[model samples]
Target: MEAPIKAPTPGAGGCGTVWWQSGTVYQIYPRSFQDSDGDGVGDLRGITARLDYLAWLGVDAVWISPFYRSPMADFGYDVADYCAVDPLFGTLADFDALISEAHRRKLKVILDFVPNHSSIAHPWFTESRASRMSAKRDWYIWRDPGPDGGPPNNWLSNFGGPAWTRDEATGQYYYHAFLPEQPDLNWRNPEVRAAMHDALRFWLARGVDGFRVDVIWHLIKDEGFRDNPQNPDFQPHQAGINRFHQVYSCDRPEVLDIIAGMRAVLRAYGERVLIGEIYLPIERLVTYYGPGLTGADLPFNFQLIQTPWRAEAVAALVAEYEAALPEGGWPNWVLGNHDQPRIAARVGEAQARIAAMLLLTLRGTPTLYYGDEIGLGHVPVPPERAQDPWGRNEPGHGRDPERTPMQWEDAPNAGFTAGTPWLPLTGDANRRNVDELRDDSRSILTLYRRLLSLRRDHSALSVGAWRGLALPSDLAAEVFAYERIADGETLRILLNFSNQGWSVPLDEGGPWQILLSTHSGRAGDRVERQLRLEPDEGVILGPPGR
Candidate 1:
């Protein structure tokens, strides 16, 4: 068993600079962002080439997805070398140059750090599997098969398979919470904890502003190796395929200690932030911040990403999240990512724009997935062309649809590649590229830019407390209304999620100023008395001031 580390004091000041508040983060999926080497895959250099575009979008930081050295088992989530950039992406110098260029553009860079597991090809795992007496043997979870010569327990992989992989050479089974190629790291070991800590320091020393920790909750597993209880209501599509609940398998109390250790390392660097990717329910997710213990600065609020597009559902989710946050803890919002279907596809193309407005107007730091600004829909990837392991294993339903190459121009491959892209580019890429949408005032891209600029210009939208407003009965379930109050200023935001126009009821006693609107036809006379909203429209009403 790994030695236990003492937890750090909560709210300890001077742990670098925490700047996540009031910040807009743009997420970049490196493999599909841009390809500078003409290798048909996006790389660090490709991202560097687009720094000006990101800066122009008015985002405070760019959260680049995993680009670490890996065997690509689960993309870059399975880290083979924590300190180096994968050759496919570029070299260390390439990453350094990307960082320098981003900083020059006033864009902070936050890299994705996968601390939960390492690639089977990783040296640590290689040594651990060599022999039972190896020094690093305890760095991974291993056990002898049961009497029936199967895995020790009934653990299941998130990708639809047994969680244990048996090694013929060693006659032992290794634990892999995801894929067999990605083995769960034994955080129970002190050496493993120290090594992971050193990895963070390595990147911070290179001038990264922060880290987006991948699967932070899965870092430490149950030490007893007990079988997870069968989940009676388990659905095939649900992430939890195991017959049992994951109480002991994941989110262990021991994980908090590892987070504290990570925080200690980041504390050494000034102003560095850690945002964790946790897929737990709100109550459990909030615990990552520690009632009084120091852990990740932002645990990543994914409620919006997973919830349906209904108004009441979204509103209740927002309220619940805002209420569940620990005292002094900040909240974050992620609407789309590489793992899930595009919000445009989930909701409609029109509704996607409204979603963007809601995300920007909501309280907390907003993270925009790549291509979300243009309301990009999921591009279908045929079985033969699919590259995602999950997609390969489970045809037609994996994340390949969302991981297609980006649409940058009306060119052949959406300007993502000069050659055929590794994955098929969407047919709508011609219309959704940056060149076509950036200048169009009616385009979703422009709407996002304007909203972000407006949010930056107004403090009420950034750090204000959100209050939900009752919507008129005529409005569809797609419409959502809310008010943000800060410093005695109230900003009313109305979003119509439907494709049909609806007249919005106004408070007769108050005069509202139209600060912004997404509708191309709604720019005429301001709302002097009552407000009328067009189909797929969004309007921001600011209190009389300026």
Candidate 2:
């Protein structure tokens, strides 16, 4: 097992630097992480039970997916109560205990705050739908039918079909950017903004360190409810939501103001973070940092998840993203999340090691998906066993594969649950589990532990200045190189993106020390001239000796 990591001394990197700036965050899908109840689903206590694992893994924080009261329509995304814990997960006291324990380990707790919409069963939504003139009627986005007696405009649900669902009782339609069960809140209403901000304060007062605001870009809609322009580049294979450019529906200029307001609420509690879940292009994404950096502390950078896994592609993406950041804005990176396919499945298993090195060494906060540390690939969910409403509504785009139960051991159900897992475990769970890999010197888990430890120990890797180095002429397309320097310390990361070995020439005159290698075969090796890299290998080099 990896040795446990002690909490960093206060202001270890710098006195004023935020914990998130130098610390790593791990995203845990609660239902898939662990199951203490033996009820086939993961819960708060289960996550608490695994706090040691996270602390040992050396992550600085835990960003738990939604565990609030819900009707399970979109799992916990369709929240019925922002303050109450879902019985499926645990109670409010259980969440308190989780926060207490996580803090004890010096791990920050970031809750998934779904502010874009609430479950249709939410008390506010229920009362809003009760009557057209009800006091809460304006809390949600309700619109009259179009002139042709059809639903409002050409808006489309992210899942499928119309974004508007007719309320037969009130003879009006309610808007839902995602599912009909998830009714979008009308942020145009001042009361709605106040209520949502209050929910944030509720958590902050309870010792929650921060929040990952869900669908933050979708908080506001165009006042005129105008039609989105048709996408000229629409492909038949793409989801229907992509048929139109989401111009009027989402990423409105007004959403930034809403995010700023939320940030202000978080600021009331010292040093708390507000991370916006925005998926816009890098140019637009930086705007969420606000015109004066008053918006989200970190607008999640998902370019790594979407970018092509090639040396040149990733290198260019990094350069573009770094160039686009607003002044004083902090950047964050994500490799895999609950929504996307696993990194192991995206790039082959060998390359995942390379990806891990890149993520940890990059000059930003890295949010790691739970199972990626052990190289968990996607698990195929059978048709009948599928649970994602999005997948059920639209065939073939299911996230169940990526959200499967974490493989902890080689037991039945992979030790995720005493009962049958809510979703299936990866096929190689027996061989590719935490217990099996923990002791393997060269295993991916060991690599992750070492990289995280190195990041913690070196200011250069934690809060350093990053610069992409020009690759040698012959190795330009196959290698991605970068140097990080901070506080008189410098480190170089070299990644081989190709499947063929290359003898990378070192012209900078470096007697380089291999600090860490993906293959676990090169640490402590001294390179006098050309450094030889095996296929799909990556290595971190210490500063040249005197």
Q: How many residue pairs clash in each candidate?
A: 7, 0
State the TM-score for model 1. 0.94
**Prediction 1 global C-alpha lDDT:** 0.83
Whose TM-score is greatest here? 2
Model 2 regions more than 4 Å off: 1-13, 544-546
TM-score, every prediction: 0.94, 0.97
Q: Across residues 120-164, which tens digit of lDDT does each residue of candidate 2 receive?
A: 999999999999999999999999999998898999999999999
For residues 1-546, what per-residue lDDT tens digits would candidate 1 score against the true structure? 111111112322224224577779999999999999888989999999999998888999999999989888888888899999999999999999998999998889999988888999999999999998889999999999988999999888877679999999999999998889999998888988889888988989889999998889988888788888888887776554546798877989988888888887888887788888998899999999975749888898888887877776887787788777777777779998888899998988888888899999987789999988878897877778878887666655589888888888988798898877888977777787899999998899988998999887776787776777766555536678777766567778888867788777776435887888887655333575678788788899886556
